[model samples]
Target chain A: MALKPYIVNTGIITAIGNNTQQCKDALLSGKNNIGKPTHLKTHWESEIPVAEIKLSNKALADMAGVNEEWPRTALLSAVAVKEAWLPYAEIATGLRTGFFSANTVGGMDLTEGVYREFKETGTVSNISSVINHECGAITELVAKHFKIEDFVTTISTACSSSANSIMMAAQMIEAGMLDIAIAGGADSLSKFTLNGFNTLMILDRQSCQPFDNNRRGLNLGEGAGYVVLMNDKAMAQCNATAICTVSGYANANDAYHQTASSPDGIGNKLAMTQAISKAGIQPSDISYINLHGTGTANNDSSEGKAIEGVFSGNVPMASSTKSFTGHTLGASGGVEAVFSAIAIRDGVVFPNMRWETQMEDVNWKPVTELQTGIAIDHVLSNSFGFGGNCSSLVFSKS
Target chain B: MDIYIKGTGIISAAGDNSEGTFLHEPPTYDTDKLLSKEPNYTAYIQPMQLRRMSKAVRMGIGASRMAMQQAGVEKPDAMSLGTAMGCLQDTEHFLAKMVTQEEQMLTPTSFIQSTHNTVGGQIALLAGCYGHNLTYVHRGHSFEHAMINAQLYLNDHPTHNILVGGIDELTDSSLQVMKATGVYRKANSTEQILNTNEPGSLAGEGATFFVVDKNPSEGSLHIKGIGISTPEDTAAAAAQLDKFMQQQGLSNTDIDLVMSGWNGNSSGKEFYDNINERFSASSIAGFKHLSGEYATASAFGLGMTMEIVKHGAVPAHMLLNGKQPKALKNILLINSYGHYLSIWHITA
Candidate 1:
C-alpha cells in the first residue's frame, strides 16, 4: 500500500516574521517586510532594497541558543527546525526519521570575508570560518545542533531546492524508507549571491512587485522554512493532527536555456499538469496557488504564461508572498510551502503586496488584498530554478 | 522493482573509458591536485555548444552520452546528478570577476553555469529529455542520494530510462583553500599516500555516469542494495553495515570481495580498519590508492567495482589480502567519508 504523506508541523523565519503563525498573521494584517537593507553589509546596501531578516548574526545565534560561532544560514535553519520539530520531540526519538534540507550560499557569507582577508594578508586567522563553506556543511551543522543523527542530507538546485526536498521526502515516506521526514531549505544574504544576481541585472533597486505590468527585477532576501511530514502509520502512532496532505508533486526540465525560461513555459506547464494528475484532481479542484513570483521580468512573464496554460481561462485565486519576503533563492520553495499550508489551514488568500496593474502578456490578476473566509481545499505551489529546473507541489486539506 | 545497471561511463585519473578492469599504472602527481584526464569532448558536443560549457558540464554531458549510446538509449527519460562542489572553476571565475571588477560588466554565462544543477540540466537539454530532472548536492552521500533517487524514479515510472551520475572538479583556488584547511597532504606517490598517517589526504576529481532501468539487458549488473548512514564511531558504523547486509539477506561471509575507501588519511583509518576486520572472510581491495580522495570519490569506486564484477576478476594491485576470489558473484563496496558511511551490494 502506498503511504500518504501529511504535513503535521511547520516552521518558518522570513523577513516578515519568525514562525508559521507569525507569517500567517503578517499575511492577514497586510504587513510587508521588504525594505532597504540594514543588516547585510554590501556595496549596494544604500542603493538596493531587499527583504532582509531584521536581525544581526549575533542576535540570530542568541535566539537559536547556540554558543558556537555559526554562519547565518545554519543559524536560521536551526531556528526553523527547532520550531518545526517541537511537536514531535518525544516520538521522533525512536522513529525512522530523516532530515532533508536544501541550501545554497551555505557559508559564503562568512567565507567571503576570509577570502578577502587572505587576499590582503595572505593568511587566514580562523579555520572555522571556512569550515562550513560547502552547501552540505550548513545542513550538517544544523542537524548536529538539533541532535538529528538520521538520514541527514542537503540538496541544491537553485530556487527549487526545498520543493524538491519536500518531494523527495514524500517519495521516501511512500516507499516506506522513512516514517517521518523534516524537509526545508536555508540561505543567507552573501555578497557572492548578491553580486551574482546583480551581475545578471535582476536585482531591483526598489521593492519587487510580482506579476505586475511594470515589474523590473527581484529583491534578494534571506531566511529559512521547514515542514515536518509523516506517514499514516507514524501519524497514528504519534497521535498528531495533520495540517495538510502532500497530495502530489512533479519535476520537469525546461531544456530551453541556462538561465532563461522558454517563452511558452513548457516545463512549467508540464510540471503543473503532471502534479495535478498525480493528485488525481482536476484543474478546477485547485482553490489557490502560491506563485513562484520572483518579480523578475523573465520569471513573471514565463510563470504567468504557464499558469494560463495550466488553469486555462478560469484561473484559481493566486498570489506571490515574495512581495512580503523577497526572493529567498534556495529557501523560496520552503518559505512558499509553509505559506501554502497556512493558506490551506486558515482558508485565507495572502495579498500580493504592491501590485497595481496586470502583466502585459498574460491576462490574469493576483489577489491584491488579504482575502478571508474563503474555501481553500487544495493549494498548488510552483518553484522554478536556474538551468530550467521546474517543480510543482499540491497540498490538500487534511 | 529491480534496477539494473545497463551501461557505465567514467572519466578519471585512470582514463576516459570504462572498458578496462585495472589501472595499468598509478597516475603520477607531485602536487595535491589529481585532475581527470580529458577526453575528446568534441566527439560528443559541438564546438558551438562546447564554447559555453565549463569543465564540469563538458565532462558530465560527454559521460552521459557515452553511457546512453552504450545502453542503446537515444534519449533517457530522466536524469539525476550529484556533486559536492559544483562548477568550481566557473564559480571562482564569476566570484573573482565580481570582486575584481566591482560587480560591473559581467556576462550571465559564468553565473548561470555555476549552479549545481547545470550539469544535469545540460545533459537533459542535450538529450532533449524534458522528463524528471533532479540534482543532489549532499557532501559525501551525493552519489548515494542520486542512486537512491534513481531507484525511486524507476519504481514509480517503470518504463522510464534514467541517467544517474556524480561529477566534481578541482580548481586552483579551491585547491589553495583546501590546502590551507589541511585537507590535502604533502604526500606525492601512491606508496607515500598509503604510508602517510597524516591528518590530510590527497585530492582527486572525476565524472561517472550510469544508465539504469528496470529491464535487465544482456551483461547488465544487478544492484542488490545501497545503504548510507552517519554513525559516531566505527563500532556503530560496523553495526550499520551489518544491518544493511542483513536487510539484503547476505551475511558477511557471503561476500566474495570487499572494496574499501581508504585514502591514506588518519581521519578515517579506524573506520576502514573495522570494515577490513568485518569482511575478513572475503578478499579485500582498496581504490583510493588509485583514485585519490574526494566527496564523490566513491562514485568512481562503485564504477570500478561494477567493471570488476562484470569481468569476474580482481586486479593484483587492488587486493590488500588474498590473490583471487573463487568468484565475483557477490561483492560489497564500502566507503567512509568522515563520519558518513555508504555501503553498496552488487552481484554479477
Candidate 2:
C-alpha cells in the first residue's frame, strides 16, 4: 500500500469555540457567532457583521502564555498549535519535522496601529511594533515557540493557503524529507483585511447564508486551525494514533480573474476531480464535501456548477460551514480541513447554517440540517481563494 | 529523480534576462536600495493584467514568461514561487490607504495584489496551467523551500516541467521602515558592497525564474542536491553542511567552485568566516557584490552558478579567493543569513 499521511492530532479556535469538540457541538446545534464587531475598530463596524472572536489581544496572549506585545495572529496560532502539539510533544522531539503555516494578513493587525501613528506623527514611536509586519513572522514566531527548527515555511494563497500548506506537508513527508509535519494557518481580524473585503463588496451585512439564492457575500471571520500529520513509520515510531488519513489533495488555478472564479467553474471542477482521482477513488467515494461557499453569489453558482460538472448530478452530501464560522480567509482552509477530518473520524456531516432556498441556476442544494450516523469514509473539502487559486483535499477514515 | 535546470530568467540590478548584458556591465547603486532594471512589461503582460499587478508581480510574471519561452515549453505542469516580503509595494499601498482613509472608501486593487501568492497565482492564470501551485514566504529560505517543493513534486511526477522562482520588491515606505530599524546601509555602491565594513548591508530586490524538469534539456545543468537549515550557531551549521555533502556523496574536492552570499555586513561575518575556512580546497566566489543583497539572492546566485557551469569559466570580478576553477564540474551555492543556511549543488 502507498504511504498514507494521517492526521494524528488537531487544534482549532474560531468564533464558534476554542477547541474541536466545542466547534463540533456548535455546528450540530446550528449556532453561529457572526455578529456586530466588539473589537475590530473599522468604520464599517456598524454596517457589516463579522464572526470576530470575542477576545482581546491581551486575553489571547494570556491564554497562549505569551507577552501581550505579540501580534494577535501569532498569539492565536500559538494557542492552536499548542493544543495540536501537546499530544505529540514526546514524539515530535528529535524528529525531522516541518511546519507549514498559511496566512494572508500576517501581523497587520498590530502594524496598522503603529503605521497610522507614524503617518500622522511622521515617526513610529516604537520600531519594534512593526517588527512582525511580514507574513512569515507568524510562522517564525510559532515555530520558535515550539522549538521546531527542522523545516518551516509560510504559505499565502488567500483562502486556500492552509489547504495548500497541508498538501505540501503531506508531499514532503511522502518524499522522505520530513517524518512529521504540522500544517495549518492562522489569521486575526484586522482593519486591513476587513476593509479590503469591504471594498470588494464581499462583506455581508448579516450572517452569511452560503449556497442560498439570496446570499449576498461573506462575513469576514478570524481564527487559527492546525493538524499534526505523520507517515506510517513516524506514527509507529512515535506511537501516535491516527485521527484520519490525508488521502489526496490537488491545487489548480481558475485563470479567470484576480478575485473571481470563472463562470464555467473549470478550476473548481479540475481541483475536485483531480483530488478525488489522486485519492485513488471515484467521485462517488467522497461521502461529504465541505464546500468553499463564502455565501457570495458568484461562488455559490460557480462552485455549485462545478460540483454538478464533476459529480454528474449524483453529488454527495455537502455543506458550507462558513455560514457557522464566517469566512476566515487564509485560515478557512485549515479550519475546514479539521472539520473534514472530524467528519471522517466521527461519521458526522455538519450542517450548512442559515440556508433557506437553493439557487435556481444550480442543480444541487447543500445539506441544511445536522446529519449524524453517516458512513463518511472519505470527506472532500474545497478552498478557493483570490487570484483564482483553488485547492481541494480528501480526508479518509484510517 | 534527476532534476535539470532547463531554462532561466532573471531581472535584477545586474540587468534583464541575458547573461551577457548582466555579466558585462552590472548596474551600480549608490542608494541604500538597489532597484531592478525593468523591461517592457507590455511584452509579457497585457493591459488589463498590468493595471492591477504590483512591481513584484510584474517582475515575477516577466521572469516566468521568459523562462517558459527559453525552455520552449508552452505550459508547465506546476508553478511554485517564493517571496519574503511579498508584494511590499502593494502591501504598503493598501496599508497606507487603510490608515489614511480610516478603512473607508478604499479600492480593492492594491488589496487583491498584496497577497504573497499573487505572483504564483498570476503566473498560473497567464499560462492557464495550474497543476500544483505553492508560494513560500520564509525569510531567507523562501526560494530554497520552493526549490525543495519543486524537487518533491518532480519526484512524484517524473515527466513534468515546473516553473519555480523567487521574487521580492523594494518600496519606499518599506525601505524607510527598514532604515528606522537599521537594516540597510545608507551610503554604499555596488563596488563597495563587499568591503563596506558597515553594520547593515544594502537592500536589493529582483525576481529569478527557472524551468526545472526531469529530463535534461540541451545545454541544461543538473541539480545534484539542495538543502536548507536554520542552525543555532556555526558548529551546528557546519555539521548540517557536512551531513548534506555526505548525503550527496560529495566532498570538498568534488566541488569546483563555491558561491557565497557574502553581503557586506558585520552580522554575517561569522557564517562567512566559517564557510571560508571550511571550503579552502574549492574556488570561493561571491555574487551579492554584483546583485546586492536580498532574501532570495540565492536565486540570483543559482542563475550565476548555472552560467559558470555552462561556460566552464568564472568571471574574475566574482572571485573572492583562489583562481578561477580549471574546469567547472560542480558548483555549490552557499548562502547564510544570520542563523539560516541554504545550499544548492549544481553540476554539468
Candidate 3:
C-alpha cells in the first residue's frame, strides 16, 4: 500500500467562531458574522469592512497561553496549533514531528507600529519588538510553545501558503522523512495587507459576493487553521481517530501576471486536474469542492473556467466559503482544509453566502444553502495567491 | 535515487560563478557587510522590467537563468526556493510608504513585489513554467529545507528537472534593524571570522540556484543527504549528524572535509572544536569569513564547495586545520545559526 498522510486532527479560529465546533455550528446555521471590525486600528475601519475575530491581542494571548508581546500572527498560529496538537499531545514521543506553517504578513502588525515610532524618535526602548519580523520567527514562536523541534519552517507563497505547507507535510511523510506534521498557516489583519489589497483595488467595501457575476472583490479576514498529519507507522503508535487523509495536492504557477489570474485559467486548470489525477480518481468522483473564490472578478472567472475545464460541464457540488469567513490570505488554505476534513467526517457541505448570480464565464451556480445527508467521500479544496501561486488539495474520508 | 546537481549558479559577494566573473568587486573579506555582486541583469531581463525589480528579485532571476542555461533546461518542472526574510527591500519600501503616507495613496508596485515567493513566481513567469512552486522561510535551514524538498521531488519523478535555490538581500534598513537588534556587529569584527572576538556575526546576503535531477549529467555533483536539527530537541547536533551519516551508509571517518559555519562568535568556539575532534580525519574549512553570515549563507557555502568539487581541491585560505584532502570526494557541510544545525552530505 502507498504511504498516506492521514489527518488526525484539525483546529481553527476564524470570524465565525474560535474553535472547530463553534465554526461548524455557524456553518450549519448559515451564520456569517462578517461585518465591521471592532479591534483592528485602521483609519478605514468604518469605510471598509472585515471579518475579524472579536478578540483582543491580550485575550488571544490568554487563549494561547503565550505572551501578548508576540506578533499577532504568531499568537493566532500558536492558538490554532495548540488546539490541533492537544489530542496528539505526547503520542508523538517516538515519532519525527514537524511543524510546517505559513503566513504572508509575518510580524508587520507590530513591526509597522514599531517602525513608525522608530522613524519618528530615531530610538526606541526595545528592539525585540521587530525581532519577530521574519516569517520563520512566527513558526519558531509556536514551535517553542509546543516543543516540536524535529523540523520547522514557514511557507510564504502569498494566499496559497498554508496549502503548500500541508502539501509539503504530506510529501515529507510519503518520503519517509517525517512521521507526523502539524501543517497550516495564520495571518492577522494589519494596515500593511489591508492597504496593499486596497491599493490593488481588490478590497470590497461591503460583504463579498463570491461567484456572483456582479462581484467586485474580497473582504480580508484574519485567523489561523492547522491539521495533524500522521503516517501509518505514527498512527499505529498513537491513539487518535483519523479525520481524513490528505489524498492529493498540486502547486502550479500561473506564469501570467504577478497578482492577476489568467483569463483562460491555465494554471488553475492544471492545479485541479493534477490534484484529481494524483488522487487516482475521476473528476466526477469528487463529491464537493471548496472554491478559492476571493470574490474578485479575475479569480471567480478564472477559477470558474478552470472548474468547467476540469469537470467538462458536469460540475460537482462546490461553494466558496470565503463568503462566510472572507479571504483570510495565508490562513485560507488551512482554515478551508479544516472545513474539508469536517465535511468528510460529518458528511456535509457548507453554503456560499451572498452568491447571488452566476458568472458569465462559466455555466455553474455555487451551493447557496447548508447541505446535509450527503456522501462527501472526497473533498477538493483550492487556494490561489498573488504572483500567480495556485494550489489545490484533495481530502478523502479515512 | 541519487540526487545530482546538474548545474549551479550564484550571485553573491564572491560573484556569479556561472558567468565566469568572480571577485569582480573589491573583496568583502574585512567588512561587516557582504552584499552580493550582481551581474548585468539586462542580459537576462528587459531593462524596463528590471527597473521595477528589487535587489532580491533581480539576483534570483539572474542566478536562476544562469543555472537554467547551464543545465540546458529552459523550463523546469518545479521551483523551490528558500528565503529567510524574503524581499526585504520591497517590504521596507511598502512599509515606509504606508507609514509616511499615512496608509493612503499607496502604490501597488512595491506591495505586489514584496511577497516572499515573488522571486520564484517571477522565475516561473520568465520560464512560462506552470509547475510546482514553493518558498521555505526557516531561519538557518531555509536552503537546506528547499534541497530536501527537491530531493523528495526527484525521488518521486526521477526525470524531472527542478530549479532549487535560496536568497536573502541585505537592504540598508534591514541592516540597520539587525544592528539595532544586536544580530549584526556594532563595530568592525576580526577579518579572520573564525578567530574573531566579536559579539555578533556580520550580515551578508546573496542568491544561489541549482538545477538538480535524479540522473547525472556532465560534471554532476551528488547530494547524499540533507537534514536539519533543532536546538530544542533532546538529541545533540552530533547525534543528528551521526544518525544522518548512518542513514547514508557512512561514518564520520569517511568524511573527507567538513565545511563549518562558525559564526565568528567565541561562544560557539567550543562547539566547533568538538565538531573538529569528531571528524578527526576530515579537513575543517570555514567560509563565513568569505561569504559573511546570513540565513542562507550555507547555500553560499554549498556553492563554494561545488566550486571546490569542480576544481578538485579546497582553497588554501578556506582550510582551517588540515591541508586540502587528496580525493575531495565525501564532504559534510554543518551550518549553524544559534544552536540550530543543518547537515548536507555531498559527494563528487
Candidate 4:
C-alpha cells in the first residue's frame, strides 16, 4: 500500500488578521502587529510589545458563536477552526473526523483571574467554571462543539505542540486509520505565560530581532491556527483546493538539555534529514526554509547551526518570520505552516523583518525583501520547542 | 502486520516497574482519592537530570529504563510517548512563580521541563537512541495514538526495536481544581469504583513503557492489532475490535483475558461495563484498581497484558473472574481515556 499524503487547509486568527487572506496580506506587506498589549493586562505591558488580538473575550466568544462563558483559549480555537473548516465542512461531515489540537497554557487566563480573586477573598466568585484548564480541555471543547466524533486528541508539547499535532495527524492519515483530521493549535496570552517568559529572562524589552547580533529576545503573541487534513478519497469527494501537500515531516528530540538545543543541532539535523528523506527529496530540492527563529540567543544560534549542518554551505533561501509575528509558542508551527502554504501557493517568499547585523556564530542571513514571481516548489518549516522537541515539515505545491 | 511486545515496564501509584508492580497484590486507593507515593527516581535517573525533571518525567524515565533493560537493547530504533497533562506540576510551578515573583529572575528549568514531549525526548536522550522520536498528547487516547504511530513506523521500516509508553502525573493544584470543577469524586465515598454511582472518578498518575518490535524476541508477546475510537463511540470501538479479530482469524472466545479500564468513574466504569456485557464470558480483569484513573492508565494495562502473554500466568490479584484460562494465548486490553476508547489485541 502506498502512503497517503496529508494536505492542509489552514485557518488563522492573529493580531495581524482574522483569516488566512488577512494573514497572507499582512505577511506580504511586512506588517508587524507587535504593539502594546490590549486583551491582557500585565505589569510589563509598558516594557514589552506583544502580538495580541484586539478583541475582548466577550467579542471573541461572540465571533466563535459560543456562549459568553467559554474560555478565551476555547474561543480563539473555535474562531480559527471555524474559519479553517467552513470551506470544508461538507467534506468533514460524515467522515472519520478527528480533532488534534494543542495549547501551551490552557485556560490559564481564566485561572489567573480567578486565582487573584480567590487570593483576595476566600470566596471564588463567578470564575468557578474556569477549572477545566487542563491540557486537553481546549481541544475537547473544539471537538465537542464541532461535533467531531472520531479520534479526538490534544497535544501539549509546549511551543512545538501544534507542529507535533500536525505531524501526528499526518501519520494517522498515512496509516489509513482516519479519513479527515483537523490538526493545529491555539494559545491566548495570559498573565501566566507573559510572566513565566519574563521570569526566564528571555523576554525582550523591545521588539524581537531574529538572527541579529544585537537581538534582545522574543515578543510573546496570542492566536490560533488550524489546518484541515483529508485523505485522497475525502479530497476527491470535496474537490477541495489543495494549497500544499504535506510531503515530508519528522520529529526528533535533541536530548541535549531541558530547554536548550544542542550546540551541534543534532536533533534538528535528524528531524530535517528524516523529513527530506520521507519527502523523497534531497536537501537541495528545498527552495525556502521557515526557520524557528524565536529571536532568543539560544534558539537562533542553535537553529542556524542546525541549518548549516543539514544543507552545508549550499543553504536554501531561509528567513525567520518570527520577527513579524513574534514567538506564538504552540501556535507558531500552525501559523508558520499557513505562511508556508501561502508561500508555495503564491510563489513568493515573505521577508524577515528587523534583521540588522548577522550573527557572528554562524554565517546565515534571512530573506530580507519580499521576493515574488519566484519558482517556489517546496517550503520547509521548522519548529523547535522546550524539552528538545524538534519538528520539521515539508510542504510542496499541489 | 506482525508486531511483538518484547518487554514492558510500568511505574504507577501501584509500584515502580512491571517486576515490582505485578509481583505484589494490586495496590488499593482510598475512596475518591489519588495516589500520593513518590518513587525513588534517583535509582534510574542521574542526580543532575533528576533535579530538573518533574514527577511525570521521573516516572516515565524509570519505566522506560526498565523496559529497555528488560528488552536487553541498549538503544532502540525509535522512542515515542503519550502524555495528557504533560508536566502540569512544572507548568503550575512556573505559573505560580511567574505571578508571585512578578516575572523576575525566573529560572528556565521548570519552564523547559514542562513540555508534553519531555518524556519521549528524555528517553531517547538517555538511551542514546537517535531513531524516530515523537510524542502524542491527545487526551483519553494518548497511548493509543502512540501505539498507532509505533505500528506505522514498524510498517515502514525494517527496524526491530521501538520504545513506546504513556505517562501522566497529578499535581495538587490540578487535583484540587478538578475536584472543585466536579470532575473528581467527592471525598469520603465508600462506594467501590465499578459500583460507584457518582459522576466522577478518582484522579491518579503513573507511567508505563513497552519495548516493541516487528520480530519476536526470545520471550515475546505478539501484538496482533490495535483499535481506537473517540469519546462515547463504544459501538465503533467494538466494531473495530471485531473487525480486527476477524482479520486476524480470531474470535472473542479466542481471547483468554480482557483487561478493562474500570476507573471507578461513572462514565469510565459504564464504558467498561458495556465491554463486559459484550465479552462477559471471557476472563475479565481490571487495572484502575491498581494504577488509578489517569489519561494514560491504559498503559499500565498494556504492560500487564504484555506480561500475562509472556509469562503465561495472570497475577492472582488482577484476576476479576475466578476462571483462569489454563494457557494464555490471546489477551485484549481496553481503556477509555479523555474521550476515546482504545483496544489492543495481543497474542502469545
Candidate 5:
C-alpha cells in the first residue's frame, strides 16, 4: 500500500524572529541574534555567546495565555504550538488531534533557579510548582492548551528529540491511528544544560563554526518549533496548501559512544539509505541536505564522511543551518524541518553562515552563499543527537 | 496489525534478568517509600562501560541483551525505548558537578550519559543493530509511545523484528522531591494497595524489553492494540476503552485477564475499580504492589501479563479475584501514571 504524504504547515519561534516571514527575512538579511544572556544569568556569561530569545518569561506566559506562574518551558512551548495551530484550529476541533513534543531538558531553567534560591535562603517557596520538570509535564501543558485529547506523547532522545517526534507523528498518521498531529520540540536555556555542556568542553567560547576545519564545539541555543501535520481527509476538509510533503524519513542508532557519532558514519549511512528507500527516490534526486553539523569536532567530520560515502561526487548542495541558528538541541529538528520546507517552497538554498574552510576528511563543501531560484525538488534534513540517535527526513515539493 | 511478541526480558527490583525475573515470585515492597535493590553491575555490563552509566541505562542494556539472547537474533530491524525521567542519576550528577566544581574538571561521561536515548543507542551498538532507533520520554506514557512506534514498524515492514522497552530508575533526590510534593504515600502506611485510601503510592523503577515481529517464535504472544489518554475525564477513558475493545472485535466477556497499574492510592484504586467493573468476569491482577509505582510501570505489567499467558496461570499473588479463565485468549493491561492513562491488549 502506498503511504499517504503528510504536509507541513510550520510555526517557528526563534531568537531570529517570531513568524515564518520574519525568520525568512532575518535569514536573507544575514541578521544574527547571538548576544549576551540576560533572561538567564550564568557565571560563564562573560566568555560564552548564546542565541537567547529576548522574550521574558512573563511575556511568553502572556502570549501562551496561561497563568503568570506557568513554567518557562510551558510558556515557550505554548507560544510555538499556538502559532502552529492558529491557522488550523477549526479543522482540528472535532477531529482526533494528537500532539508529540520532544524536549531534552523539561523545566530545568525553573528548577535551577529555584534550587539556587533554596541553597541561598534554605526556603522552598519559589520553585515548588516547577518540580515536575520531567519530560511529560511540558507535553501535558501543550495538550491541555490545545485541547488535544488523543495520543499525546513526548520523545526525548537528546538532540534528536524533535526529529524523532516528527518521525513518530508521520508514522502514527500513516498507520491510520491519527488524523492530524502537532509534532515538534522545544527547549529553553538553562544553567543545567549550559554547565553540562561546558563541563564536557563542548561549548565553543566564541561563535560556533560548523563544517570548518578549526570548528571547536557548539554554542547552545534555546527556542521551539512545531508543524501541523494533516492527513488527506483533514487537509481536504480544511482546503489547506501543503508547504511540502514528508515523503521519507528514517531513524538509525549509531551504537557508538554516548555523545559522538561513529567514525565510519555507518548509522548515518543507514538512516539516509533507509530514508531514500522509503521515499522511493534515487540518491541523485536529492537537491538539498540540511546537515546536523553541531560545530563539534566529532559531528561535522562524521556527518561529512557519511554524506560523502552515500553521495560521493554527486553530493547535494548541503549546509549546516546550525551555523546561523545555534544548535537548539531538541528543537533543532523541528526548526530545521521548517527551514527545509522553506527551501522547497522558495526554491532557494540557505548558506552555511561561517563555512570558510572544509574539513580535510571529506571532499565536500557546503553551499556557502544563499542560492536563489534553484530547482530544489527534494530536501533531506539530518538530526543526530546523544546516544547515537540518528534520524533523516526527506521532504519534497508538493 | 499482525505483530507477534517473539521474546521478552525484564530486570527490576523484582529480579535480575528474564530467567530470574520470571521464575521468582514478585517481591513485596512498601507502597509509600523508595524501593530499589542494587544489582551486581559487573555481571551484566563491563566495568569500564558501567563506570559512568546511570542506573536507567544499566538496567536498560541488561534487559535488552537478555531479550536479544532470548530471540536468538543478532540484530533487530529497529530499537525503541521509553522513559519518564531519563537518566536522572546522571542528570543530577552533572548538575551537582556544575555547581560544586564550578564546571572546571568535568568529565564528559555524566553529561554524555544524561540524554534519554543513551540506553537505546548503547543497545544498538552492543547488538550491532543500526536500525530505526527512537526513545520516548513522555512521563507515564513513555512505554506506550515506544509500543505504538513498534507497532507501526511492524505494520510497515512485516518481515522485520523490532525491540521495544521502557526503563526508569529512582534517584534519592527525585524520590525525596516527590515525597516532598505529596505524590508518595506515608512510609508507615500498612493498608493494601487496592484497598488503600491513601493519597500517594510508593516509587520504584525497572526495565522491560520485548522483541516484536510478524513471525511468531516458540512462545509468542500477539499484541493486538494500545490506547492512551490523560486524566481529564475518567468516564471518557472508560468510553475510549469500550471503543478500543469493540474495534478489536472483542467484548468485555472475551477478556480473560486484566493487569492493572493499581498503585495503592485512592485515585489509582478508583481508576482500576472502574476498569475492573467493566470486565467483571475477567480475573484482575495488580503489579505496582510488587514493582512499585514508577512512570513506566506499565512495561512491568506487560511483562507480568506475558508470564501469565505463557505459564497459563495467574501466579497466586497477582490475582485480585480468585477466578481464572479456563483458557487465556485476551489480556487487557491498563496503567495510569502522571495524569495519563494507557491500555494495551495482548493475546496468546
Candidate 6:
C-alpha cells in the first residue's frame, strides 16, 4: 500500500491495432474492430461476429520471430512481450527478471486439431504438438522465448486473469521480491472458445453496443497486452521514465454464481472501493474509468449498479474500449490497461462506440466520442470475469 | 515474518486426510495410474451441486472444507491455489463436443466448469468469502507460487488466516496424451516404481490444502523458504539448491531430512543422484513412490512431512536410503516437473 509500482512501458495488439501507439491512434479515429472476423475459422463465423486479429499463425510467428509450430496464444504473447521487453531488456541482466502471463485456452487451438485427428482415425502422429496444452506451458514457451528465467508464473482467473497478474507483479515488487516484472496476458481466437461462448448463447451477431439499453451480448476478440513494471531500484538502474505509477489494485470474488455476477455487482463494488481506499483518494478524484462493459446484459447491468453504489455525484468521463476491440476475454485486462496507461499519458478518453439508449439502472452516460487534451491524473480500469473473479487497478500520473 | 500451518487436508492416493482422519499407511496403487482416495462428496458438498462438479472441483472442495473445519475458519481472508492442469474432464468434454458436433447445440455446463479457477470460485462461493483470491498454473512452480502469495498476504495482513492449496486431476484423455509423450507407464507394483530403470514413471493426481495463519496460537509447522529454479542443465539443479540454501542462511547438515521427487524413471535418475550427493548425511526419501508423480506432488510431500513431524516417525516405506533420522527438524522438499524445479524448506 505504501510503495507505488511504476509501469515503465506497455505493448498491445488487437483487431484495431498491433502496438500501443497504433491502438491510441485507432481510438482517436473511433475505429470499430468488431464485425464478422476474417481470421477465425468457425462454423458460426458467418452467423456470429468476432474481433479476430487479421493474421495467420505463420504470420504471427514470423512477426514474433519464433517457431511457427507454437500456439497462436503463445505467438500473440511473444509479440506483445517482445515490445514490452525492448526497453526493459537493457538493464534486465543486472536485475531479477520475471514474466507473469495469463490465458484461458492455452494451446487448445493445436490440441483440438491433433485430438480431432486422433478421434477420427485412432492414430497419433506428433504428440509434441499439444505439449503446450496447459496454460502454464504457454507461459513457459514465451518466457523461454524472452529468456526470462529468474521468475515465471501464469494466472487464469478467467477474464479478470491478467488484471490479477498485473496486480500480483506489483505486490511482488512491493514485497521486495523482484526488480523487474513483465506482466500481462494473451488469448487467440479458437474453435473451442468460440463454441464455448456460443453454447452460453452470449454472442452478439452485430458489433457489441456496450452500456446501451438494447445491448444483446458481446463480440469475442483475441490478442495480447503486456506492461513492464519496476521498483525504484530497477527504475534507477534502467534509467526508466515512468509512464504511470500503480496506486492500488484489488481482487474479489462475486461469490454469487460461477458464470454470472451478483445482480448488484458486489464484487465489482468491493474491488473499486477497496482500490480507491488503498490509493488514498476520493471517488471524485478519479479522472476516467475504462469500464469492463462486455456488452452482455448481466455484465453491463451489474457493473453499472456497482459504479453507482460507489460514487455519489456525476461520474467522470468513462467509456468501454471493448466497443472498439470487442471483448478480448482473458486479454481484456492487459489490453485495456495499456489503453488506460495511454489514456492518462496523453489525457485521452476513448469512445464507447455506440450508445443509443442508456440502461435504466445507472444515471452516468458513457463518453460517445474520443476526447483529448484534458488533464487526467487518475484512471480506474475494471476487469470482471467468470468464476466470480473481479479485479480493479488504479494508475496515477507519475 | 513467520507463518504457522494450523491445519492440513489432503485427498490423494495417500488417503482422505480430514479431521479425525489422517494417513497412517499410504495406500499403494496396484495400477500405474494413481487416483485419489476420495471421500463421500455428501460430507462436504450437496448432492445436487456435487453432480455438476468434475472430480478436480470435488476434491478441491472436500479438501478445503476439511482444512477450514480443522482450523475453525468459516471464511478465510484470502485463498490462493495451484493446479498445473485444471479441470481436464470438463476441458476435454467441451473440446470433444466442439470437434464432433461442429459447434452446434451444445450445453454450457462443461464449458462453465472448465475454467482453471473453478475450484477456488466454488470454495469462495460456498464460504461467502469476498477476499483476495488467486490461482497459479506454472507447472512445478504452481504450488510454490501459491505458497509465496500466501506468505505475501500474511506479510501485509499479519492477523489474516489464508487458505492455500495445490490441485491437479488426471483424466483418460490426458493420460493418453501423457503416454504418447513417453513419460507415463503402467504399474508393476508400488515398490517396483522406486527401483525402475525404465523411461517413465507412474501417473498420479491429488489435492492438498493448508490453513496458513500468520498469528496462530499454537503451532510447530513453519515454512522457512520457498524457491523456484529453471536449471539450464542437469548439474545446475544442485547449484541452484546451494544458492537457495545460502539465501536462507542454512547448510546441508542443518537439514535432517530431504524429501526429493525421485519419480522412478531414467529421465529422473540424474536428479535423484544429484539430491543424494547434495544431502548425503540427511535422511533421504521420496514420495512419488507412495503419492506417485504429478506436477504438484510436492504438496503431497509437504502434507506427509507435516504428519511425520506431528507423529515423530517416518514411515519405513517413505525412506529410500533406509535410514530414519533420530530427530526431525528442518525438512527440505525438491520437486521436478518438466523443465522446472520447486524447492521448499519446511521447519518443525
Candidate closest to the true structure, highest lDDT: 3
> Could you give candidate 1's per-residue lDDT for residues A257-319 as a string of tens digits?
778888989889989999999899999999999999899999889999999988899899999
| Tens-place lDDT digits, model 2, residues B1-348 | 368998888888777765354575545567777888888888888988788778899899998888888788888899888888998888889988888777767898888888888888788888888578888888888888888888887877888889999898987777777777777778687677887567777888889999998887668989878888888777788898899898888888888889898898887777787888777878898988766677888898898887677666777778888568856777788887556688888888
Off by over 4 Å in 1: A120-122, B18-22
TM match of model 3 to true structure: 0.97
Query: Which ranges in model 5 have alpha carbons more than 4 Å from their true place?
Result: A116-123, A127-129, B20-31, B38-43, B102-104, B188-191
Candidate structures ordered by DockQ, highest first: 6, 3, 2, 1, 5, 4
Question: What is the lDDT of every predicted structure here?
Answer: 0.85, 0.85, 0.87, 0.78, 0.80, 0.86
Q: How much native contact recovery, as a fraction, does model 4 achieve?
A: 0.56
Q: Evaluated with DockQ, which candidate comes out highest?
A: 6
Show model 3 residue runs off by greater than 4 Å. B21-30, B187-190, B232-235
Task: List the candidate 4 regions with Cα displacement exceeding 4 Å.
Answer: A1-8, A91-94, A116-128, B18-21, B26-39, B102-105, B186-199, B231-250, B266-278
Evaluation by lDDT, superior candidate among 1 and 5: 1
Per-residue lDDT for A246 in model 1?
Answer: 91
**Cα displacement (Å) at residue B288, model 6:** 1.1
| Candidate 2: pairs in clash | none
Candidate 4 C-alpha lDDT tens digits along B188-209: 3323765666677777788888
Q: How well is each residue in A95-132 modelled by candidate 3, as lDDT tens digits? A: 99999999999999989887878777776567768889
| Model 1: lDDT of residue B87 | 86
- In terms of lDDT, the poorest run of 10 residues in model 3 chain A is A119-128
